[model samples]
Target: MLLAYIDEIGQTGAFVSPTHARFSDSPAFGYGGFVIPAEAAREFGAYFNKQKRTLFKNEIPEGTDPNRWEKKGSDLLFARVSDDRPQNLRVFRSLISKLDALNGKLFYYAAEKPCGTPKETNTGPREFEAREENAMRETLNRLARHADSGKQQIMVMMDQINEKSRKQRLPVMYAHILGRATEHEDMRRIVEPPMHIDSSLSANIQFADWVCALVKRSIEYQLVPTSRYSWIPKETQLLRDKEIFTFESKLHLFHRAVDDICHSRILLEYRPVIDPLHTSTMNEENRKNLSESGKLHSVNKLEQPTNHAKAP
Candidate 1:
């Protein structure tokens, strides 16, 4: 069994942007992917639960009422500081930093459009969308390379997004990549299981809760790193356009909050080789060779075809 832990980074709601009206106004697009071996899945789940407990206690104190917490809107969090924003840029940078720090090979697919693009506008082509699809294909191809030798099974889990437009992108992207995997006979047998968690029931709610707690911690501690701060650049840019200052500061704070949360939760280390026999292609090949050493079959051997003739 293979398990992929997936999460998306972006807003699924409609927002206005000067560049395009219909584009997802979400500032950044990101997905965190991890392929977990079958035997390790349950163990990882338990580990994740433990981590969650620690995070909750650290962020929300033990006696606090968890029911009072609700998912905070990213936009709303930044709104007080800037009518237009710079916070998203900080969040974007932090995400990139976190991705860079991740230890094991992780597959990431992201499409980021400038904020404020309306959902209805029919802009011609989106470069970010193309980039995201390409990334997904490349990642899938890498996985298929290992899978073709019967080394690994593909399993994925991801956070659900709200935009109907973006919802279709993932499966289509997967299909395109899988099409290229046809060259490997073993790759042809790979199957993608239906997505496991329902957004309304379990995973989504849990993710929202996690984000909320993180955000609150950010706000309480003013934990945004100075180096990661968005103001340094925005301060310079604002000299040319004074109007940006008002929104930039607010956006910066909001993003700093997001950065703090993201930095803390990023998965650092994970053991990928769970089942040594299945995970190692070389081992499997050696085992197969040994098993087939004495086997013999006629070159023309074929099972008789089943007969269910019609009255042709």
Candidate 2:
């Protein structure tokens, strides 16, 4: 069996550009982490704990439990893309080596979000839930494919959230996406809906969060070059803007790291996918039109159009 631990990256809230007064949070939203065999999880956890303590020995509190003490990946990996030096990124390269030894892969799935209207802050509760559902379902589909290729079954684990109500909600949609009705849910490749654990208690989930953070910034650098990465020099001039030679160097490093680690199996989705449930019930022609437009628009609970993204 495969054990897949995952976590969220980027905001679920609506965002346009970095300068937007109300709605600027992230250019995308997605899930990321790594997958390994069930037998190796505990051993990997031990190695992760040791690495964490060593890397953050000065930062962690003296008396805090090393296993329970947590660090946000954003804080650890911030300014990664803008910086030309690849020293900090060695952590990922080391992680990739460890996972590769265990026959695992770094995994992530994200969708470029729609640019929202000026002054819009949130995508509203309904729209937020819809995006969550969308990301989870697509993630399952991709993971299921991986399991199928291996002829192995997999279980998903994620960090627990403050709101326990979602525990009841995420699984129903997950079962549906797996082609099982909620009432008659049975597993084939993916064992069941994701099991949630307190991140402080699980080094695996903590590692997942860090991987998610790497994916978040790498994707923001990819999708929103003009907005989130405006600080990076755009022109290719060695004499001028020497500190910031080009975004290409950043992109090159990003690609090298991801390609070296993922081995072409990086699962980050390029577009915000329209959930199949939303379109499944539609008549054939409407679905055709929706596909042809190359735009994915979302609907709010009140049947109003909400956040949307252009397909790339």
Candidate 3:
């Protein structure tokens, strides 16, 4: 069996419209994390803790409380150049190397948040949660495939979310999805429901936070094209070389995967607002086609909206 620790990089709030001021700040949303064999989970956590203590021993204040001893990814990766740049960079690289040697795999799903009115958006009349659910579904599906290939099942643990609705209801939502996934392999490979754990207790979840931060930073660099964060891109290149880091630069196109399997690509769907006249014309054409084929079904059921619809 494998254990996967999942974390999110950006917010999944109900702020899909560009008119919202905060939309500009976080135009993209991401979900990612790392997966390792069950046996390796404990060893990796212990090794990571030891590495942190040894590498940052000098930075720790004398007699500092053990609970306060924390090294966050944001501070380590985005630190100012004057703040132990060489040492911190070395530690970060060493961490990545250790993860690679341990056979940890990284997977993620990211998308540009849908903008415009409900009808104009890729997902008509859907809230931001829908967009997040789509990403989650895709990620879980991939995890299912991975588990099946290894002849093992997977259990997922995510960093705790404080929101009552999200924290309590997300498990139920995932259960419903997995329950209805009769045609997919997720039902078999993903045996256990996703469990939430605090980052302080689960070092694996903390590592996932680091992976998510790195992925989000890489995507942000592409969106803005700035030279200030040169280290991010460099580290991202190393991540791609080491693990199964996957990225979706745009809808319907994927990059940076270990294997570029065409059949595994997620088909992106785009929906434009249809005018009344055009809708009527399409309906008429559909009826004509159905009549020609002696079938009463006028519209394509596959084209109709389903729970699997995702943002473009």
Candidate 4:
């Protein structure tokens, strides 16, 4: 069984509109983490804890606690560590190597925020929530594909949210996308309903938090050419070389370019309708014209028109 430990970097609050109050440093929202075999869960947790202790060497800071000592991807990559960045990097690289040895793969999905209209900003909730939902759907799609192929099952373990209501709401939201009524629900090879855990106690969640932060930083760099974040490239390359990160999958459907391309290609496979009234009806005049020219074929070839108005 595959277990995907999922986490997100960035608030779900929309920051797309320049005039919006929430607009800040982050330009995109990222959801990603790591996946491993279910049987290895306990072993992975033990190994991760050992590595964390090794990095800090039990030298607990005077004021900082164990939770604060826990290595974080953002802090390791971006913040100053003992005034020696290279040394900090070495420790991080070592930790990654240990993870690489476990043969786990990284899964990520990022959605670049879209600028919204004034009306949208004031009336409807922003697109950030929708993007998050799409990312989850795509993640499940990949997991489902694996389960279908291997005849195995999977589940998602996510970091706990601060909000009590959201903690319960997220699982219900997942059900809408993965439950029996959803299209391609078979792809929800993630059999168990998703559960949330305290990152402070769960080594798996902590490790996943680091990976999610790294992916989010990398995405921020990609989306903004002039961004000054440096160490992201080096860390990103290491993850890539390990062959653990899965990039550029079908879950990037929210990208306008991808959506447009898919639309154009799918339209070619269906007959184009010139008259809306004749969409379902066979016009006698056109039928006779075709029959006279020997161009008429079996009417059974006519496919029921799909509802284009509802196309995404």
Maximum-TM-score candidate: 2
Model 1, 1-312: lDDT tens per residue? 455554443433332431344542343334434444556555544443443344334455567644333223343234232325444333433322332233212333332333343444333246445645654554445445434434666655555555674566657765764665566554443466225454333323333333332223222222222212223222223221222111101111222212211222111111011111222244656556534642111001111122322101
Q: Over all chains combined, what TM-score does candidate 1 have?
A: 0.40
Q: What TM-score, over all chains together, does every model reach?
A: 0.40, 0.68, 0.67, 0.67
Model 2 compared with the native: what TM-score? 0.68
Would you list the clashing residue pairs of candidate 1?
6-157, 16-116, 17-116, 17-117, 21-117, 21-118, 22-118, 82-247, 87-251
Query: Model 1 misses residue 297 by how many Å?
Result: 59
List model 3 lDDT by residue over 1-312, tens digit each: 888888886665423432355443343565777778888899888876777778778888899843337777676667353244756666666777776787767766666554443455544324576766766766666667667767888888888777895665578657855675677655577866677787878778877887776655554443333323445533444554453543321222223222221111211111111111122356667667655753332123214444532332
Q: What lDDT is reached at residue 125 by model 3?
A: 29
TM-score of 3: 0.67
Model 3 C-alpha RMSD to native? 13.3
Rate residue 11 of model 1 by lDDT: 38
Supply every candidate's count of residue pairs whose N, Cα or C atoms clash at under 3 angstroms: 9, 0, 0, 0
**Superposition error at 40 for model 2 (Å):** 1.5
Off by over 4 Å in 3: 13-25, 58-68, 79-84, 115-126, 166-168, 243-312
Cα displacement (angstroms), candidate 1, residue 65, comes to: 11
Highest-lDDT candidate = 2
Angstrom error at residue 116, model 2 = 2.0
Q: What does the lDDT come to for candidate 4?
A: 0.57
TM-score of 4: 0.67
1 versus 2: better TM-score goes to: 2
